[model samples]
Target: MDWPAVAAAAAAGLAPTTPIAVTLANRVIACSAAARAAGVRRGLRRREAQARCPEVHVVTADPARDARHFETVIAAVDALIPRAEVLRPGLLVLAVRGAARYFGSEQAAAERLVDAVAAAGAECQVGIADQLPTAVFAARAGRIVEPGADALFLSNLSIRQLSTEPSLAPPSRENLADLLWRMGIRKIGQFAELPRSDVASRFGADGVAAHRFACGEPGRGPSGRDPDGELDAVMNCDPPIDRVDAAAFAGRSLASTLHRSLEAAGVGCTRLAIHAITANGQELERVWRCAEPLTEDATADRVRWQLDGWLNRRNAQDRPDGPITVLRLRPVEVVSAEALQLPLWGGIGEEDRLRARRALVRVQGLLGPDAVRVPVLSGGRGPAERITFAALGDELVPQANPDQPWPGRLPEPSPTVLLDDPVELFDADGNPVRVTTRGLFSTDPFRLDAPGRSGRLSWWAGPWPVDERWWDPALKSGRTARVQVLLGPDPAQALLLCYRQRRWYLEGAYE
Candidate 1:
């Protein structure tokens, strides 16, 4: 479900038929189906979307509002399955076996849940499958997959759908989908044919994870064996926490303590149960199931989301009469972290790597999905173009085939940083340095200058001609030449400089 668009329309008091776009950072993140018909799409800038469809209603993305409104729907689903695990604010999954047994058929259970959601004032469809990801795809098509036929069910799906549905593939992996298509793996089954180990080596850890999803394997491979002792974190509110801010503060504290405990046990939580007691003695609980192990910040997010849902639910019968007085987090399922397969090659050991990942995830949660990124090797003529930065947790798919010959790639020991704002080089007479048509410097460069960096050149190398993508006129970069320059006494103080269109610019710096 595109919850953002639905929540935005409802909050703005717009009818469901009205085209809506939920924007964040001045770009459309989600849009109503009607908006799609009108040519508005996600990732389009606000002005472009408006130009595409002038009647499209634009609204800001509000996660809290989305959670609040979705609470009623969650409650309705809970009525059918008390232990149903919430995957996100608008999505949930229940083991169909018990429900099917109770309702006498899987179809009946699906219809029952659909009607329940309808009564809650939201439309929903149910899909049953052996694996969650397959079920997500099935739900989208409103079809029930046959028993143990998840692979068959997923075989024909376009790789396009996996990235579009956040629950199936994450960290917004539209790039992964495109990479697969470019590699001639247009369908889920085609990609699934690759061996798991080979996929890991070629596309990295996240790719293997996606393979499992495509193959209809479990969400993650970590086995959730029982741990030695109780792993629970609790916090009691002195004055009932009535505000979302207060709940968030409490959640962070609890999450931090819980994370330390999990690390000590050398395990991670795949399933978490959030328990709360209201001032009126009403007990509320919800369980969250994650595709991968939960980080501290992710746990806190679940806590905050659950509390917000409870506090803001509009149902008169189900709403908490009094504020929440107690909150407890319990690990419903724990997996041995030592069994957790992290990236095969990294600088740090397993423990340090895990800690680093947690910190990055926490920062991303605090900031946004783009707050942190990791490099994925890509084919290019320059050091900066050799790799692309993908957000952490996403598949490390290359931008282009690295195996293909890159005739003019920079020599070994590439620069550590690529300057977005290139530095300029000036001649002894203060004229901008340039490489002549004869493939020689127009004038001897004297100084290199940038915002915080300034130096007189000590020594310099030849301006090697760079001609890239010459075969594709649309993709071709105009004539440029690179030079290596050292400043002052240290070999460590080296810069990668480029001359283009009669102007000198700094491309990178050697560490």
Candidate 2:
């Protein structure tokens, strides 16, 4: 609103010579007069601010803190006005009709608002008008115009202020004002005089609302409360955290926020979104989903997992110097409160599946999200083509029975040891004879090797040469090697292995 008042208030929180400024990461969100006079303006980078105002006091914008502080100020106002809606951080909207009647005038209510914010350790400029946007601009402009004179008051103001929607667009406030000047709408009053149909056809709905706002007409009803209101809360840091540890600490705060919100709403959340704001004005957003509704511990675990995920995804070339300043956690989907239902007879393995899912998530946190997977049967004849890694909790399509049994398919009970990249092996004699490229290998009758002695290869099996998917390039051109092996008990009653890659390696035993 009033740049001077905002500057003064912001400066009051800093050293006298400190050029106070607010930034959302690297971009300046707001700046004091002293800072501006030194050439520091909103949207300037932190480096640019330092270059312009060497003594600038930079404070990262903390929307949650501002929101909390605003809530306290509004609570005080509610003590007097009873009903109020917080439109944004540092902005409050109230029905002044009742408050004005009680306080004897709208000016009195405005004064009270300013006084209340001041008492709450904040200096705010209050604006009183019929339209919310007009009042907002009046507040920012640092003026309190009479209720009935809003049109006259807005007429002289730049049209840019009418189009201000902080949460939506990125155009500079001054640029919007300049555009209005070029459009020959020098004042809010002139813009308001334009036909609504013409305004809507040209500038869209936002423009129409701005026009009505300039006319001093109430553009809309009070801001509606978001249905997922319990998902909101603020994190306050002592001495202002500015390190990586601060982000970790903020994660705890986010967990607490979610816990409180969910407790109040009597529900649990299935998904949470964390928004981290850095001192340099950068925002990192991450979303976490749980297979089951989460508890407080689970929520924290998810947050930690998300942070790790972010670190893994970022390039080593660029990393933040300081810790995150603020972390906002919002639960996007809240599930109804329900107890875990256990089957009386336990016919299906649902409990085991749930446990497996949790274990997979834990492993993912330790190894990396993509490092672990469950093998699912995909409809195909070849071994490599039939098996696919599935993410935890994903539904699996059953493998179809081939029109004819795969002639070379391995016998029941697949090998227990499965390596991602299997090594090649050779026979004891160092001969090149081994398993076929298609998982078929001819082995001479062999006996198992024992600690005391070695036996001969006995009861050799398949030399079944099976051709795999020759059509698919990804598999055919690369991993199309076939394999053949012999299965028999060794002298020690343990199964021994030999394969084609010009060497002998233990594949596995057949129990």
Candidate 3:
């Protein structure tokens, strides 16, 4: 039942100051205007950013909160536009051509959208273009491209914009942009001029997609695919399910069935549409747009997030009045599967992963979701922070990262034993060891007095500083200090220690 679990948790750590930097995997992804003025930039690690500007507040990323709060924005948009395709929580794509006509002009429609969202307490920009990619770039620059100038608008832009949409672009696009930069093809126009055949032969499928986007063409290209008849997975919820917990279980099973159908057909889903019917007969549907094919877990995540948002809506008009009686997942867009190169000898674990997943699901069914959990690696600056637990059948999504690195993190040989409570650390005088407000250790630790963990320290390591979330009062823990100590015979056993406000406590133990 313990499941050796880890839950996905990301919390920002730093002083509560105006110049703030939000980090994931220890690298900066966003910063406040104040931080930017002080020389902090995206991709700068906390160590370097601190050197550049010492007053900046560094925070870790929290994906759940981002998605949870974004639902209100999505609801605001849904009120105006029925099905604006959500690419991620903050970004969306909708065919504004019709809205432009209805509003009398494209500019007018955009203004209306901005006002609607602003009413919901968020700022936004709109872009008009002949193609999706062009529109995406136009939105970034807060400009409306001319009726047929999608190509021209994107031509002069830098190649770095190739990965403009993080939720949509493949990782290779970023690498491709770097490759082009090194080859002297600095502008998108230059890359767009390459021969299609050459791009296909050299850059492969992803390259072809990028070329098409830069040329003001659609990204799907000529796959000429079909989801066939079995692509839609529907479930008739007999007793009805309105609670988030029930929805989570349904999402897991439905996601697996949908993927099995896609896998059997040698295709993958690109866009997913979730439709639900409540007991009151109210019908609801939302479409999700993705840059690439949706993996089973990705599909499940979207399902869970969407349903959770709908069920938890604070607005009376937005929340469902009754339990859901019918639920269906339809793949609105599909593409042919491409052969993937494996690691040659290490690709066999996929079957094992799937088998383990099934066993966990069976356990979940027998004992309930919370009883079966699994450990997940998440972004953080501390040992316990790196690990999180998720219900077995749910998607294991890690928060805060396109990559994982923690600067100020302790070196490896992680603790094999985690302590539930902090143990007291003592000096030779029987007085508790302490840390000063200036982050200085009061004195060297001498005796350990933690019941069975008691011992005399032979050697010790730091009083390393850890400060997180001072800005948010509900989540802030003032600056804390940590140290490593060898205890018992030869100080044979090792222990991790934490100090806060005149108290010392055991954190963990090493083998």
TM-score winner: 3
* lDDT, candidate 1, 308-390, per-residue tens: 88887776667787888998888888889875655667535856866776777678657765778899887788887788787
Any residue pairs clashing in model 3, and if so which? 6-375, 6-388, 6-389, 7-388, 7-389, 12-59, 12-60, 13-468, 423-506, 489-492
Report model 3's TM-score to 2 decimal places.
0.72
Q: For residues 1-511, what per-residue lDDT tens digits would candidate 3 score against the true structure?
A: 0000000111232232367776666677677656788998887877899999997666665444455556777778778865677777666778776678888998998898899888875567777787777777787777999887888898999998897567658877899989989999999999999999999999998888889888887653212233344689999998899888788778777888898898888888888888889999998777787887888878888888788878876566768879999989989888787733236675578779877876776677667889898888877766677777877755564554425555667677778887746678778888877887777777767987886878789889988887776676775345678888987575499888877555766778898
Clashes of 3: 10
For candidate 3, what is the lDDT? 0.75
Candidate 3: list runs displaced more than 4 Å. Answer: 1-22, 31-40, 44-60, 220-229, 339-349, 362-370, 376-511
Residue 354 local lDDT, model 3: 77
- Give candidate 3's root-mean-square deviation (CA, Å): 7.5
Candidate 2 lDDT score at position 316: 41
> Per-residue lDDT of 1-511 in model 2, one digit per residue for the tens?
3232243344345544457777653567677767888998876777788898898776655433343234445556666665465444456666677777888887788788778767755567777766666676777777777758878987887666644655222234445557668988776778778889987887764565556667877554342333354576556554445543334445654675677667667777665666566566776654444434666655655555444333332334334344566667777666666532325776488558545655665565466545666777654433444576754422333333233345556555655553233333335564444555545544443343433324545444544343555566665232233333443344332332433234444544544
Q: In terms of TM-score, how similar is model 1 to the real structure?
A: 0.65
Q: All candidates: CA RMSD in angstroms?
A: 9.5, 18.4, 7.5
Q: Rank the candidates by lDDT, best first.
A: 1, 3, 2
Top-down TM-score ranking: 3, 1, 2
Best by lDDT: 1
